[model samples]
Every structure is written in structure tokens, then in C-alpha cells.
Target: MLRLDDLTLFTRTAELGSLSAAARELDISPAVASAGLKRLEQQLQVRLILRSTRSLRLTPEGEQFLAHARSALHSLESGRQALAGGKAAISGVLQIAAPSDFGRNVLLPWLDQFQQAHPQLSLRLLLSDHVADLFRQPVDIALRYGEPEDSSLVALPVAAGNRRVVCAAPAYFAHHGQPRQPEELRGHNCLLYMLGGRVHDRWSFVRGGESQALTVSGDRVSDDADVVRRWAVAGQGVVYKSWLDVAADVEAGRLQVALADYRGEATPLNLICAHRDQLSKPVHLLREFLQQRCAELLARVPWA
Candidate 1:
């Protein structure tokens, strides 16, 4: 008989491209994961993966089985949830990923309250500016901004109305003067943030059926989005950031919006999963909680 554990190990190894990584996620030793994969291949009588010291790649047979394996897991999970009346306690550790700034400034306190509400549920959060590979990473879900480019992942709206804003500290504006229009931002110092090796210095906006873009320059730059926001709050330079990220700062009068009439880029927040099967009751509830919290936060300001 085939073991479900073996199937899970095989699928995770294929997705992560590392037996060790999959084992770490599943809370098993690398040797155990390797042995499980070997047992599974032996039972199926096919070469599943071409393994090497420094690399791991799925063979054609493994590639074909991967789809079926994921489907099977999904079906089993669905059955289990259905059997539990969809009221299963949201226990176990949920691994999540989010942007650095939002994770620290916004999500941290919210998650704390959420965990308090569900004492049985634990959270593992990965904070980064770079996008996480939903298929490859160990994270069960990710909180991201903007519409997801990959169609395979399931995206649930957390804050669909969220948008970017151009803002800076009052001290900086007092010294450099605030721009009344989008185009005038060219004369001010703009804090730049880099992601996936590209510097986001080009500020774009739209207002009254007109569109404008400006390539602003600044003395400070950081790959970490949180650092850029901090620089803006410290009066270092103007920043083009997600309103959800800077909403509290703006509300507290630490930062002031520039060119509020012009609408900046849309940055709709979402909770994304690699597979629909991953959307358990906990995930759905988390999405709703996030939506409400985000709505409340944005309501404090008229920027939404």
C-alpha cells in the first residue's frame, strides 16, 4: 500500500527541488525524506528524481506524478475539512510571508491579537521585500500587494481598495517645500527602494484622465522597504509607498501626503496561497480579519 506521508514528501521535494528543504518543512530528517522518496519510487517502479550533491531535478515520471500527487492531497484535505464540518480548530503553525514594512508595522500587532483570539494557532512569518515563490517556498500563504502575475496561485482580497501614496515627513516638506502637482516631485528628493534588482524611482500618477510619470533621484536607497519608509519618516526624503504602510504615519502627523488629488498606483493587498487546498478555515478567517483591520486603518484617513 502507498503511504500518504511518502506522497507528501515526494511532492514537497519536487516543489522545493531539495530533499533537505522538504524534510525541514515536514519536520523530518533529510535521510528520512530521501528514504521515503526511494520507497515511493521503488513501489512505483520508476525513476522519479535525478539527484545530485548540489542539485535536484524531477524526472519526467516525477513531473507527471507531481500533478496527481497534488490533486490527491487536495482531495484528501477537502474531505477532511468537510468531515470536520468546516469547524476544525485552527491549530498548528501557519507559515506566512509578507513585505518587511507591512509585516513589522501593521501585521505584527494584528497577528498578535489574532493569535490571542486563537490560542491554539501558531504563526511563522517571513518578512522580506522580495517576492516569495509560492510553489518553492515553505510558506503556506503570503500577504502581498498588487495583483499577482502568476495565475496558478489563489489570491483572496485582503484590502482590494489599497493604493500607493506619495508622502514625506513634515520636517522634510518644511525645508524642501511640498509639491502641489505630480510633476513638481521631480524637484524634491525621493527615497528609492529596490526590488528584484530594479530601483523604483519612477513615480507614476493619474488624475482627471491625465497620466504623469517622473524619475526622481535621492541620496538614500535601500532594498528593504521598511528602511525606505523609515527614511521618509525621519525627514530624509519623499517616499512613494503603499497607503496601508504609511497610513498610521500620515494619521499621526509624522508624514504629509503630496499631490493628494492625483491617484498613485494601485496596490491592492491580497492573501495568496500556492493551491486552493491550502485555503483552510483558518486561512479564510485570517483573510476576513485582515480585510476588516485594513479597512478600519484606512478609514482613519481619507486617502482610500
Candidate 2:
């Protein structure tokens, strides 16, 4: 029989694509990790991975065995949880990636409460506007806006009804006036956000069966969504952002909604994992907690 530790190492190495990364995660040295993989491969009588100085990839045999390995590990975990009377203590380092604005402004406090509730759990959060490669990166999960394009990944909805909103600070509206329609935005300085090297200057909206998408210019642009939001809050320009990102500001009267009659694009928030087996009990609990918190926050905005 294959050793469970070897199985875990194999899965982690395959998921992370780096022996060093897997070793670090497991708190072992690279030499030990290499020895374990070699032992497993020798027993199986097949080379599982092709490794070089700069790249690593699985063999076809390894690719086929990966599913069975993951399933076996998941089954063992489930059995262990059952042995604990279905209340296994949640204790592990949960590495997560999230959008910059929500991660810093919204999720940081909520995560603190979560950690307080489960003191045994640890967290590593990566905040960025760029999409994280789940297979290549060290993160175990991601909190992202919009549904994932890759249907193979599991996506748990945190806030499905959430959408984008056109907003600006009261001072900005006082000076430049609010754009009543999408077309009028061309005359205003719209704060733009950049992602994956593309500048998002186009704003789209729909109202009463009418749809419009207009490319709006801006005096400033930033790759970080949080920066653009701060610019908007500073009364620098108009901003089109997720309602969740701007909801508190709107409620506090720092920012006011523009084109309330027009419905902006949907931006449903989701918790994404690369594989189903990655959804442990702790992950499920966190998802539920976030769903409740987001619902409460969204409820405060009557127009959203």
C-alpha cells in the first residue's frame, strides 16, 4: 500500500507544480520531499513527474493517478471527520487570494472576526487586482468578483445579487454635476481601473429595455481598484465600481449614486477553489460566514 504521507506530498507537489513549494507547505526540506517522491515512484514503477531547473510537469500516468490520489485523501479526511463525531477541529493555514479593494477595506475586518472565532486557524491573504493562477500559485482559494470562466473550478456564491454601481463624491457632483445618462459620462472625468494591462474606460448600463455602452475618459487611472475608489471618494472624478466596494461610502454620504435608474453590470462575488476536494469544513464555514455578512451589507443599500 502507498503511504499516506507520500500520497499527500504527491498531490501537493502536483497542485503547486514545485517540489520546494510543497516542501515548504508541509514543513519539510526539499531533500526529504524529493526522497519521498522517489520512493513513491519506485514503488509504483513509473516516473510521475518530469522536472528540470526551470519547469515541472506531470507525466500522463501521473495525470491519470492524480484523481484517485485526491479522492483517496478526501475520503480519508471525511472518515477522520466522522470519527470526530462530525465536529473535527478546524486547524490549518488557509492561504487565500482576493481583490485589493474588498480584501483591504471589507474582508480584513471580517477575516479578523473569523480568526477570533477559530483561534486554531491561520490565514495567509494575497491582495491584488490580477487574477491568481490557482494551479500555479500557493493560494488555496480565491475571493473574486464575477463567476469564474473555467467551469471545472468549484465556485461558491457569496453574493449573487451584487452588481456594479456608478457613483461619485458629493463634492465632485457639486463641481462637475452628475451624468444623468451613460452618454453624458463622456463629458465627465470618469475614474478608470486597469486589469491585466487593459484599461477599463468603457461603462455600460441598461434601463427600461434600453442598453448602452460608452467609453468614458478620465483624468487618472490606476491598476489597483482600491486606489481608484479612493480617488472617487476624494471628489476627484466619477467612479464605476462594485456596489459591495462602495456600499459603505454611499451609506455614509461620502459618495452618492449616479444614474440610479440605470442598472449596471452584474458582479456576483464567489469563493473559488481549483478542486472539489479542497473544500474542507473550514472553507465551507468561511463561505457561509461571508455570505451572511455580504447579505447584511447589501441590505443596507435600497437601490443596490
Candidate 3:
């Protein structure tokens, strides 16, 4: 009844000669490695390792287990690599769902390169703000802006440290006079973006080492984010949005940033799959490619 992960850890610890060393090599915390080893020992009703103040020595039984476990782990790893390796020749229509603005502005161009790299792979891009049901929809994967609430799907990191910004056109800021903090948003006309049939007017931020949220009011609301961006650029009102989406406009001086002191909440980007076992070689390639590209794009922004 030894856990597969614990067995892998046991072999790693045996090879490294120390639990902490194995943890470092495996990119896991020492406490987790220690607990995994303890779990393995308890399951087998055998003392696998003897721990000292500064070192680790395997019990006689542990040494015997290590030999068999190492061989088994190698076999399992070879099988996994084979599956991953089969991805080199991906030929099929890979369907991916993404948010409307990001999909159009960022992902569409990226997909063009991906198609070039894998000539045999046909692709279908589904763009919408509505969250796709991975289990029900005909989608192989999805790129999303925030953590999914559904426990059934696996969220893989595409990009991290993506923060939103509160901004407006220079003309609007000049007419209204820019208010300083998050609280001042109430005095201005805030642009609202509709998602899932509801208006998202609550803007979250961090001010003075504490988390704060403000429910903003505005004269205009639109389901299409691009429309909201357009309205903001036309000197209509303040808008809260992903910095990356507005990075070009902000840089081009189309919009001016507000509340520079308040830090916007980080909205991580993720590539989600319904099940790891269902992941094919194309999926693996796409996931890795986007992970790299998305990080690069997020890092392109310069903010105060």
C-alpha cells in the first residue's frame, strides 16, 4: 500500500543520502519529504530510514526496498517519457477556449506561430468571456485569467504576477481632476465590464499594507471589454482592467493611470485541462509554449 509518490521520494532520498537533499532536488519542502517518508514506513510497517541530527541512514529493510523502488520508478518514468515524447508529431484539430480581448489581441497572434511550428496540427480557437465548461464543451484546453472555481479541472500556470490597473483618458482626468486613492473612485464615473451577465464594479486593491475593495459606480457598462476600453480611451470614465490589455494604450498615452499608490490585485493566467491523463502531446507542447510566451508578455509592462 505504499504511495507511488512516497516510493519515488524514498528512491530519491536513498540516492541523495539525506531527506533534505532529496526535497531540494525534487523541488518540494523538507517537511513534505519527511512526511512522505514517514507515510511510506507506516504503510509497510517497516522502518525505512534512521534519522540523525545531521544525516540520514537507511535501515536494512529500507536499503532492500530502495533497489526495487528505483527499478520500478525508472520503468514508470520511461513510460511517462514515452507518452510525452509521442507529442513530437502532433496532427489534429486542437480546440482552445480563451477570453475575448486576450484571445483576439494576444493569443490569436501566438496561435499563428504555433501553427507554423506544427504544420500538421489544425486548430480551433473559441473566444468568449463566458467560462467554457471543459467537461461539456468540445475544447481540449482553455486559457483563463483567474483561478477556476471548479475542482474538476486542473489549472496550470501560464503567467503569474499580472495586476489590474485603474486608468482613464488624459482629457477625462483633466476635466474631473484625478482623485488620489481608491476611495476617490466614488467621485468619478467608473466604467463597468459585464461578465457572466453581471456587472463587475467591485475593484480590489492593496493600500497601506492592507487589502481593500471598492464598489464603483459609472454611467456606462458594456459586456464587451473592448468596448469598455474604447469608451475609456474616448474620455468617458475610469476603467479597471488587466495591465497587459491596457499596456499598449497606456504606453501610447491614450489613457492615464489613476491611484498609482494603490496596488491592484494580481490576476494570474492559467491553461486549464479537464484531466492530466487526457493531455496529449499537442496539449503538452501548447501548454509549455504559452507558459513561456505569456510570462514574456506580462514582464513587458513598466508600472510604478
lDDT of 1 by residue, 268-291 (tens): 999998788888777888888999
Q: What is the C-alpha lDDT of each candidate?
A: 0.88, 0.89, 0.82
lDDT for model 3 comes to: 0.82
Q: List the residue pairs that clash in candidate 2.
A: none
Clashing pairs in 3: none
Which candidate ranks first by TM-score, i.e. highest? 1
Q: What is the TM-score of each candidate against the true structure?
A: 0.87, 0.85, 0.68
Error of 2 at 249 (Å): 2.0
Q: At residue 9, give the lDDT of candidate 1.
A: 95
* Model 3: per-residue Cα lDDT over 1-304, one tens digit each: 7678898788767756778888998899989998998888988899989999898888899877765675565456446757767645677668799988788877788899999999998998888888987653556689888899998778888787788889999999999999888888999999999988999999988877899998999899988887898899999999998876787788789998887778897878888976665466677889889888877766765445
Clashing pairs in 1: none
Which sections of candidate 3 miss by over 4 Å?
1-88, 302-304
